[model samples]
Target chain A: MAEGALTAELILGTTEDVLRRYGPAKATVVDVARALGVSHGSVYRHFPTKAALREAVARRWLERWHEGLADVAHTDAPAEQRLRDWLSTLFEIKRQKVREDPELFDTFATLMRENLAVVDDHVTGLENDLAKIIADGIESGDFAPRDSKVAARAVFDATNRFHDPIYAADWKAPTIDVAFSAVVSLVVSGLSVPD
Target chain B: MAEGALTAELILGTTEDVLRRYGPAKATVVDVARALGVSHGSVYRHFPTKAALREAVARRWLERWHEGLADVAHTDAPAEQRLRDWLSTLFEIKRQKVREDPELFDTFATLMRENLAVVDDHVTGLENDLAKIIADGIESGDFAPRDSKVAARAVFDATNRFHDPIYAADWKAPTIDVAFSAVVSLVVSGLSVPD
Candidate 1:
């Protein structure tokens, strides 16, 4: 029923609030239940265990970024432009996540460390998005002939510094915008057909 | 005077043995002194604190890598070949570090996390070695006009998957070499002056 769907959505939304206030180490389902004014049993009904609850929270948080990236990947623009927009969208989403809800972002960062399988799926999904764009480019003759899968992974790894939380501290650096453009130019040029 | 020098060298060598035998968190100055069969006071004379001792060991271990990189950076060969060699050398070194003395490497990884200044200097030094090669390429017109420092950083960042310890787990992934070459080629092509 739609009521069941609303219950899960309400739990995930309240979970974010709890995590932001108490962080991963201390946040609990009871906290989420209290935030939602529901019994702890109700929270457990949605997520079987604490780990499941946390993992679902982590998955929900990550998918929001993917949704933005999906829009850019499937855009009607040229493949090259779509690739650029994809990277730009990814960078902007990460930067905004850090700036807008730093505490929640920090909580998810810890959750990511705790849940590698979730992180792996998230990375696989992102790389697949990149591959879709590169595949389009290869098909249109805009990109050099190559293994689109390998090339997509390379592009993802290449631009990791701009998006990975590991280098988040450098995002605010003064010359970062220039550096981002230079790297993007290099990537775009790399993919283009030789003159 | 040479006895004093030998004492410091002996302490450092024993510290490496101690750390390898018992990981970083458990290793201590007294343990290091005991390994060398010397008074702990003597170790303190050389390293004022446990942190200082660990910092020196980390610096010493990291410098060995830099020394190898420096040879490749300043090689009499062409800049493009040197760049290739440099990346190959880095991948091999990181692979060897994990394969050979994983415990010491693990200890240093933790030390690096604990000591940001050392990590900063090490990164700056590595980037400088990269910049030197890039500056040479720019001078010889092998590379296009741009900020050499920025380009150097991008190159370093681009090849990070092959070298950075954080991604050590993926270094052994099937098709990683293909991914590595794709990225290296992309970066090299990006840097080259168009025909």
Candidate 2:
């Protein structure tokens, strides 16, 4: 492989593939290089270290997970409806990742632990998306005026069980959807202006 | 020691000490037996297996943790006030455990994972306490008439981040208390019957 042709994105995709096949504990920078038909030095040029590579992979995966929700946050709908849709979409995305790609989900979860800054950034990004919708709600008089950022954080924290990976096992419960709906309703109710 | 002196409570207390000193992985039935000046055989007669002993210890610990909350659940105060007090108290108890005795807290968390049935039962017991408070609120017309059991579960799940061991690391953040109060206020607002 030509050295000039190897990019960070290319290296990250190969690393993700390596992680999927070998799992988090055994996957390494050398594996990514071998998969890319390049030397480990080439991969190092892109990621600098194994930790950096893992962090990049986790960040990219989390970024993709919330892209749809960002769109939902900005949709031209009633702020309440948009907030509901945004949260539901976010929950469904996480639930699907847990249910459908549990191996990859587990891999990212392990990576996320070692990459706390990336996880924090991802959470902050999602919270910002939530805050935008909440701010819109306040402007439209649908919700009571409050600190949108704080309200967003509260809403995000309130639904931790539905979206947080640590509670992934509980997501499969028969009543999980009902529980999710209940939380969303309560949160929306809490935000709504009293009639 | 007298044969009759080897009570289950004695064994459990010794086990907790052993666990706190040696941690969840290293602590064993033999250590508990050694600490109590009894044969491992005598301990086996009461707990049957190491797993059983660990489960019993975890159950006792969790039961103790919630004992005070059970009182708050049954208090004569306004249901809303009682509910807030119960939740805030529960959060404080868990936060203290995480901050003041992280090692012991971690050992219990590991033991709890191994003894999931014990964990589930403990959660159900706590939810029952919450349900009782919500039922009272409904009766007093402070909250809308809803399924108290379901509302209890929702409240418990919603506040999970403040109390769940996995999120313990985030508990020490400067804004955690504010974030927690925000969630509690949102939850209480959601439960109250709007005028």
Give stretches of model 1 more than 4 Å off: A1-6, A37-39, B1-6, B139-141
The clash count of every prediction, one per candidate, is: 0, 0
- Candidate that would win on TM-score: 2
**Model 2 lDDT at residue A151:** 91
Error of 2 at A95 (Å): 1.2
lDDT of 1 by residue, A51-116 (tens): 998888889889876676787899889999999998998999898888887777777788888788
Candidate 1 residue lDDT tens string, B11-103: 777888888898888998889877776678888988999989988888877887556677888888788888888888888888778878666
State the displacement of the C-alpha of residue B64, model 2, in Å, after optimal TM-score superposition.
Answer: 1.5
| Candidate 2 segments exceeding 4 Å error | none
Candidate 1, TM-score vs. the true structure? 0.88
Could you give candidate 2's per-residue lDDT for residues B114-174 as a string of tens digits?
A: 9888988888988999999999999999987379988888898889988787778889999
Listed for each candidate, the true contacts retained, as a fraction, are 0.50, 0.69
Each model's Cα RMSD: 3.1, 1.3
